[model samples]
Target: MTEEDWIAHDPDPVTAAELAALDPGERAARFAKPLTFGTAGLRGPVRGGPDSMNLAIVVRATWAVSRVLTERGLGGSTVVVGRDARHGSVPFAIAAAEVFAAQGFSVITWDHPVPTPVVAFAVRHTGAAAGVQITASHNPRTDNGYKVYFDGGLQIISPTDREIEAAITTAPPADQIPRRPVHPADDTLIDAYVTRAAMVRRGDHGNPRVALTALHGVGGELAMRTLRTAGFGDVHTVASQFAPDPDFPTVAFPNPEEPGAADALLQLADEIGADIAIALDPDADRCAVGIPTPDGWRMLSGDETGWLLGDYILSTLDATDAATSVVANSVVSSTLLGKIAADYGARHVVTLTGFKWLARADAELTGFRLVYAYEEAIGHCVDPAAVRDKDGISAAVLACDLVAHSGAQGISITDALDRLALRHGVHTTAALSRRVADAVEAAAMMDRLRADPPAELAGFPVGATVDGDAVFLTGGDQQTTVRVVVRPSGTEPKVKCYTEVGLAVGADLAKIRERAAAVQQQLLATAQSW
Candidate 1:
């Protein structure tokens, strides 16, 4: 079914009014499925009439959010609005503010561009009932999105998003959603965020040559300020994308993980002989690091970065005061961290992939301090005291600190990784993705796999299979038994298959890598067939 199919059969009367206000093509497009506030709020292509994240969609989403707060006796509740440097992000943010104001909800808007993590932090720090950020994260330039956070400063999840979506789905006409008389977003939130972030330190690292790139997004200023605050000097900003450009002119998706997104920085690093290169995506919540290794400027994987940050933070904090348990997403590389925590005498817990899962697992209640958290997708949530959401700013600072500390110890961050690998026996992982024509197709494929899982995958005997509504996992770690987990992308049109191979190489890292490469290819081919 097309986008029109989702909206063609709108069951709610409130949806009809939104349809009437749109032009013919727009009405058909939006009627597909009104963007509902999911656990992470609305995110999609920016052009689907009222249902999509156009000016109209932003207005309606804000109105719906404000309406929910008002109905819960917070009619004049305050909300914070922030936006990244994506196409139409600023306009969508402003539109969200206007709708909140029109609904008599107080709105505090950021004047300048900011990261989504900071917006989440602001919602918690300002004591606001909700927050809105306009960004599609790592998606391509053609897309934009809206994200909402709960009062505790994390993304709304489960029944909460469902409840808000229900209200939005059954609300009055789009034009009828309430608005206040004045702009409530004082625009001072930006300054507050800047000041707050500038307080984090990078230990004794001072006056180091660091190359920074924003990937044509809005992270440059924040990253520069952060480095300066951490006592780094002689920082070089890559010229092509030093400022905010909604079009993301320099990169295809503004995601640092995407191929070639960091090419400019890599070139700049080579020209300037910089020590390391740091890249932030459009929204800046995710960061990538490239170091000038003997092999030239090599970008580190999300797992490597996570290991460095987690180890550095745990080592820095006093063991006596630190929580006894550390939490990480299930898909993250935990080999190094597992070893680190074991040496530190801390328990390591793994939750389902995603920040939403980490935030809701109540690690704190369970005696887990949540000192640090990360996923394999370059997302990190550090400084639980500052923001329950993932903040690349803190993670970046931590990385700088790790580098500085390693330097102080007469070593390099890479050396530290080598040490961890030596200690942990070297674990390797890989993820493969297959794009489907539609979500229905993806779901149907998942259903079929659940119904008839193979006893063997790629000539390897299957240990067991996990069959869930959204995914299927068909293996366990054993001799000649491989592990593969298949799940549909929660926010995009792709089926992701994760494979892991654990080989105890006993300090023979090269052999481990070669075997892991062969296993990755075999698992990938098997996954593609599904």
Candidate 2:
């Protein structure tokens, strides 16, 4: 079929008109390649093309999901759907529900925008066969996406993702796809999530002055309510970014990890003398934290937050039975968590990037219970048993509880970090990423790195190289450690390199960190050149 055929079948007039206005060259570019669905699901700019995220794409994707479910003997199963406040998200979500309903499946949908984790929780809470969340996560406002969760409320992996894509290829067109009214989602699920989130707190730690921001997405109201319910009544939200604005006017990008993205929240923290600050991504599935330091206020790296939370949870567990308690981080995350777990006699597991793997650490292990899991990209799964996904609201509440407890003991978050360093080695981490024109270039880069690995990084001799979808270069002798993992991002068109350096606990941490930063820069420069 040609572009005209696609436009003819499009249900949304706005997208159809946009496609009709494009020139011949532009039209070919738009339809030349079909969007590929992977572990992250379908995501791209909101445009009228097979390559973009439009009504037709969503309808077809939903139809494919329905077919896949039926083929697996779940034809009449319940499917839950939810959306963020992104452009075209509501209509796209509704379209998905309509497709599901048309396929003889029961559909449940949220009336208002909610966090992605809520939808994931609803899938498990209601025993639905599948769930879909319309969001772009921390991507730019111009982008939108579809994320799928299976029966266990975990994102689909491996054969499932591939099977859905195959079904999409043979699905009917948008106009031919059937539609039906969607049922209202159960509000009880939301209440249940809030209650479960509040329970994550260990004790009645007094409320600490906290500043929070939603980054102009849909997490504002829910986050505030959850905090207040968790005994944190002194929460202050960034006024400019509290509301769900699709354009995200306050920041160049909605991701809290981006430079200056959390400026407004930091400023608010200083103004209110907040003991801690938190920023949630657009979908509220990831969290970024900031704390007051002696010189000023600074945001904690994802690794730092992961270490703190992992340590706190492990410390509270019954050490006598640490073998049954497990903590996990990604392959690229800091190795300090392993040391902390060992100190507390708990087990530690490492997996590939993404919570889809981290959340299932327990299931993969023989007889261990996953107490906590985190990745270095500000994604934390504090209560995997309840949500089984990264939940910013729950993480924020837990962070606040930690802060309140630390304050009561006359120590700050920084003080806790110092103590951690004193016990374990000072571990530092850095990341380097490069955007490429296309996937071909990314593949070539990875292939080249694996075939001819770097002999050395900075002044350290390269110890070993392991190859996979990502390539790992290890450095240092038997005493210290340095590592760099280079790979293409699964969800975006970029190649990312992760680097880490470990120093003995007694070394001057400041100077060691500075040297590590220099080494990271050198490694990044070499990788970029390749």
Candidate 3:
């Protein structure tokens, strides 16, 4: 169909007006290519055309999803559909539910907005054949998405993703697809998930004063309830961000990892003298942490959170469980997790970036359970068996426990980090990222970096370089291991340069960390030029 035809049949008036406002060339440009799935699902700006997020695309995509599942003999099975409060999310989700219902499948969904984890959890809880969640997570305000989870409550991967993409490309047009209005199910499953999240932490360490923020998304209500249920009574939420607001007015970006994203939370934490602060992304799939320091308040790098949580969770593991369990992190994350896994006798696997890969660690390793998995981008799957994806609510509950336990010992989390450093070497990590106009620019940038990499970086000679979808540079300087990986983000329009400085722990732990930070900055600067 032509662009004009798409506009004529477009279901949403907003997108229809958007298409009518654009010039013929610009409007046609959007139709030059169809929407494609990245990582697990289709995410793009919500606008007119098949290349973006709209009711028509959502309908077609759901039709494709239905087709793929039916081919696997899952016809007439259940499909769980959900949405966040982003622009166009509600209608997109409704359109998807219509497709599933029209296809004669049992549809399970919620009347209200829910976090990304709930959809993932409910899929398993309901014994559904597939799940669909309309969320863009922490992307900019104008963006939206359609995410899919399969039978095992795991994000779709590899051949399955490709199959869905193929079906989406060849599926019927939106107007031709029939949809039925369906009633949403009760919240029993969501309630069950919150209760389960509360149980991820162990023994009752007294509830220390906690500060939290949902970054103006759907996680606020659920996160607060889960933490309180986990015995963390002294919780304070940033009131301005406690409610679900699609615009995310308080911060320049909704992501907790972005600079200044947690500014309001830090101020609140400092004012309340809170023991720890937690920031959950818009969809609550990723969790970022902050703690008090002698130098005032500061957010811990995702790596720091990973190390602390990894240590705490592993410490709770029994000998039998630890022996047969697996831990995995993205290759770009700090290598400290691998060493920690070794100390605990747990298998560690370094998968490609994205939680989609991290979620499949146990499946890849036969006869092993995946106890923990994390990515340095503020994502943690502490309860993989329950959620099968990064769950900010569970991570927040467990982080509170970590702080509470440390307080009971009459020490701060910083002291816990010092102990970790003393056992494992000091691992300092930093990133240098470059934004691009589109994937084409990102590809050109990667090619340029790979064609002429520096002979040395931050005083470490280039000992070896591994080239593929990403480039890995490894070398050493004065017993410190220098590691760097440059790759295009699977979910965004940018190329990320992840750098780490590994140095031996010394008598002056602070002094050792200072050296590592300086080296990491130098490495980041070097990577910036690439």
Candidate 4:
């Protein structure tokens, strides 16, 4: 469509004016590519172009969502809608709610912003046909996203995402679509979420000091409440980042996994001599952890925290239930969790990299329950039953429980990790990313790797599995076994590589860990050249 057509069809005159003011070349770039539903949902800059996340795109996407639900015989059923504190979040959320209401479904939205997981929980709690959360999670300050959860509270996958894209392509313009005004729902949904999230704590033994930071997102208030309800009252927070701020002035990147994003939290931990630290992503769907070490304060990699939480949860389950429980992680994550699950007589599952796949892992086992799931990107599902998606808030509660249990035994999470390493070998992980000019270049890079697979990576003789999708490289050297998964990034013009190195703990565990980490660095170096 032309700029004039888009401006005429835009429901909001403000964004329409923004679109109208663009010059020809600028307009061409804005309309270069329309946003497609992928990597969970629609995410982009909240701007006024058809390609950007404006009212025109949101309205059409919601119409498609409503149509998809209605096609499945779910018309007129309740659908929960919510948003986080971000640019255009309020209007986008209200527009989505009204679209659902006009499409003949009951709409429930919040008066204030909320974490992404709360929207997932509210979906399952209220038996809503679906849920929509307007958030960007850990993305930059200028971005926003739309995530949809079905009745089970897991993000939609497969043909559903594809179908929505097709429907959006043919959907009517925003101004032509009908919408009914919808009011915010009561806050009982938030209360229910807090109560259930606090139930993830498995122990009540020791008092450990805790420090947390929300990174200027909307999770601080509820995270504190959940911790307080779980009997872990000794908590301190990074005051500057505790409140919701869309600008995210304190950190260059809002993601806790990014370097220096958790600096303030660690500094506060050192100041308070806290037993543990928690860093929640902007929307509180991912959690990164920090702990004091003999050397200094250190933040655990997502995989290390995964091992600790996996071992702790498995150790606490009833023996009877252990046999019927499952722990899961993505294909590219460290394999140590599988070893821990095996030691506990439980099963482990490796799925495509996303919570949509990890959250639904139990379906494959029929009768088994998904006890836990973690991705190397600091996403954890400590209480999948309460909320099928990755929930940093619930994961924080569980992390505190693990800290309390370790403190009662006069041990630390570091000691716990060491024990796991001694039993299952040291697992070190890192990533290699190569940015290209565009997705086409990224695809060519992946295609070249698939056509001529590497015989060895980082000096280890390697074996490759070149499926049409991603390339998985595995090999073993004298000191370590290196595993790597390479694919193109979903949101950027780059190819991403995830590498992990494993070595059996020898007489000197520290030396073995160092060797493994060195191998990881070499593996990343080799992958970078691809």
Candidate 5:
């Protein structure tokens, strides 16, 4: 629709006035392109335009989802809607719930802002046809999003995403779209989630001092309560980041994986003499862990945490079930999990880069059950049966459990990691991401890499180049192995390179890591020059 038409039909008077105040050029830019619906769902800055996330867009998306559900013979089915503490999240969620209600679907709306995983769990707990979460996860304060989950509480993928996009294109204007009063949200769902989260604890172990930070998101209270209820009573949360703040006052970026994001939590851990520190992303769907080393406090990379958690979970399973047991990680994640799985006589599957794939790994494989799944981006699915998504809260609980178990046996998490390195080798991973001016530039960079691939990276000879959604390069011989995968960010105008180097397990882990870090820097520079 034209800018004038959008202004005329916008349901929110405030947004309409904002658009009316804009100059012609600004208005044109706002409507220059429509927001594309992809596997991650709709995410962008919150503003008054077809390309931005606003009340009108939420209404249209909800209408499209209602149509798709009805077309799939799910008319009048239950649809659960939830939101986080970000700006405009509550209104957008209410608007979505109203749209579903107007379409003759039973809508369940949260009474207050909650974590994204709560909505995912509620979808299955209530047997809803689909679920919608109004959040941007760890995006900046100015951003918002709409995430959709299908019947099994899994995010929509493939043809489902495309079908919803088509429906959105044909949706009516905001003024013509109808809305109805939604039913009061059932608060019991949160209780049910707490109950299930508590069940993730396997046994009683030593009580290790812990520190946590929610990064100014909505997951703090729930996460802390769940941990205490699960028998980990000694826990302290970073005061500055405990409350839900849309502005994320303490950090420039709310993501735990970002530089300096977990600094506050680390300092807090040290001050309290805590055994470990845990940081959860804004929406609590991803987790980042930190430990105290002789050098000082250090945050563990996503791969390191993944391997630790993957191995810990694998060790708890029975040998008789190993044949049917499975552990999965993304293709870009470290391959150490696969080796760990193999050692236990279990299978490991490498999927595309996203929890959407990892969450459904069990269903895709016949006769095998997914015991654990993780991605390189601090996402872990510790209990897929309860919540079929990357749940930071549950993962945090499991990490605490591991810390307690290790402490009881006179070993710290650091000691356990060192032992794992001795058994599985030192697998160092790093990511190089560059923001481009536009999608054209990102695609051009990808094309350039594919057409003239690097002959060698660091000092290792580049052996093979494989192409898919991304381009991957493999190097080194049987003694040592290195891998580089380059691809464009699915949600942003950027190209990302993931590199991993493997060295034999031995006593010189620090030296091996230093060498690997130097090689990673060289590989990143080489990719950038290309």
Candidate 6:
């Protein structure tokens, strides 16, 4: 069927009886097709229709994954399972584990919810064949997800993602599948995670006045424990969101990067004069920071935070003479690490925008200690020695430590960013998205751009075009980018565009920013026409 036809079809295509049984919105939501697993895994609303993520879908995915693993001679292998505090996540984790155990795989399940990255860590540390995490990362509360990690606790990337998805698309009969009871193993991995996270702390402060929120998800208790263990004191918790609530009662979007998502924490920060406000996603894998700025409680952009943490990690490494290398996702703002690498005379590399790529690269490469790897999405991987995956808990501790170091030097994160921009060339990035009619349309649009791309944008000559399903980098160094990358929404009917603009390394920050802003307008216009 054509792209137009797919979008025009009724989402539910259900009978009158089923339609009558649900609210209008509910019916519509149910009708829409939930996404299947991708390279990054499955994510969508928990209560949506046949396609949405729910107990049934989770089980189906688990069964499918198990079947594929069994066929690959991995049936008896141990599988590590973890979950965040998203609504229905624990049950989903248990469901997945039960399915895996019933399929005859040994299961090591966490007793309490933990960050997504910890699941990846456990997989590698425990020598499990694969891992599964119940989380939607930074998605809205209505959403929950299932992310799979293969051997080495790395995200299942291309070719492999396709292989696993093909197996899922052709699932065996549900009746033939057996549902097993999930038994939780004695998981000491969480403690190991905490110990490594604590290593991110630098100075001793007895304890810092910290304000934390689970955001009505799973981060609050574990985060507080880690902070306290790291010698941070006076941890103030947000009253309403202190507990895990799948509904995410207090926030519109569960992600901390969105505007006003940190409003409550910022207000509390003002009242208590806390050192910093740390917010985790529903899954506690991605983190956001809200620190006091001269302009008010200004939340640092993910790029800004990544830059700060990268600088701190590099600086600490220099003092300790630790053998380390730096890595980042292709989409992140490179305001620090490149120069830092130049200073240390180490290697720096960029991968496609996912931990799957990062972790796999880490295992494949050698002589390069990966001190840190982060993307602008607030996903950070610290302690490459411990967990070769993004660990929000570690990131939070490192953020606290970075703040402490800055405090001792009488500087703020904003000032740190300014200094980095001054040292490296100022870099700015923006992402814009359009809700397409369906996947087919999105694909067709991308194909068209690939075939006959624009020659220029807003009078800036198109330097080049890098077209991948998940990445598109346009323009060259020294020339401000008029770039547009197109990627289908892993969980929704949207095509995301990542636009970036960078001036020469020595260009004036303010003037380059203005020019980049103007270029971005033209880039968006070009993209809309596509």
- Per-residue alpha-carbon lDDT of model 3 for 253-274, expressed as tens digits? 8999899999999999999999
The regions of model 5 sitting more than 4 angstroms off are: 464-466
Q: Give one digit per residue, the lDDT tens place, for model 6 in 1-530.
A: 22223223323223224435677676665655556666468887665344567665677688878877888898899998888877778778888898899889999996678777678878888888899998887777677888988867878876666676677656543334566886676647888777767877977633456777767767777788888788777789889888877777788877777666888988898899988888887667778888887878867767678778877777766533444464555543443466655665555667776776666544555665677788777778877766777777878888887887787778877778777777766666666668788788888877776777766666666644554575454654345545666677666667877666666554466676677677777777766776
lDDT of 1 at 391: 77
Provide the lDDT at 484 for model 4: 92
lDDT of 4 by residue, 58-177 (tens): 999999999999999999999999999998999999999999999999999988999999999999888899999999898888899888898578899889999888888778888998
User: How far is 325's C-alpha from truth in model 2 (Å)?
Assistant: 1.7
Assess every candidate by TM-score.
0.89, 0.96, 0.98, 0.97, 0.97, 0.85
Instruction: Show the lowest summed lDDT stretch of 10 residues, model 5.
Output: 460-469
Any residue pairs clashing in model 4, and if so which?
Answer: none
**Lowest-lDDT window of 10 residues in candidate 1?**
5-14
User: Which residue pairs clash in candidate 5?
Assistant: none
> Which residue runs does candidate 6 get wrong by more than 4 Å?
1-35, 47-50, 110-112, 169-171, 205-208, 319-324, 332-336, 444-448, 451-454, 470-473, 476-484, 504-530
Instruction: Give, for candidate 3, the lowest lDDT window spanning 10 residues.
Output: 460-469
Would you list the C-alpha lDDT of every candidate in the order shown? 0.72, 0.88, 0.90, 0.90, 0.88, 0.72
Residue range 1-530, candidate 1, lDDT tens digits: 23343344333334444655668765664555566654388877766454556665676567668767887787877788888877778667777887887777777886667888778878878888888888887787787888888757888777768777777666654555554444445546656666666555546754557888877777788788777766776689888888877687878767787778889999898999887788887788887888878778988888788877877777766777455556565543444566677777766666666787766545456656777777777888767667887777767776766676777778877788778777765656667778898778998988887877767765666754554434544443553336677788777787877776655655567777787678768878877888
Better of 3 and 5 by lDDT: 3
Cα deviation at 375, candidate 1, in Å, is: 0.9
Cα lDDT of model 5 by residue, 181-242, tens digit: 78677678898898788778879986778899999999999998889889888999999999
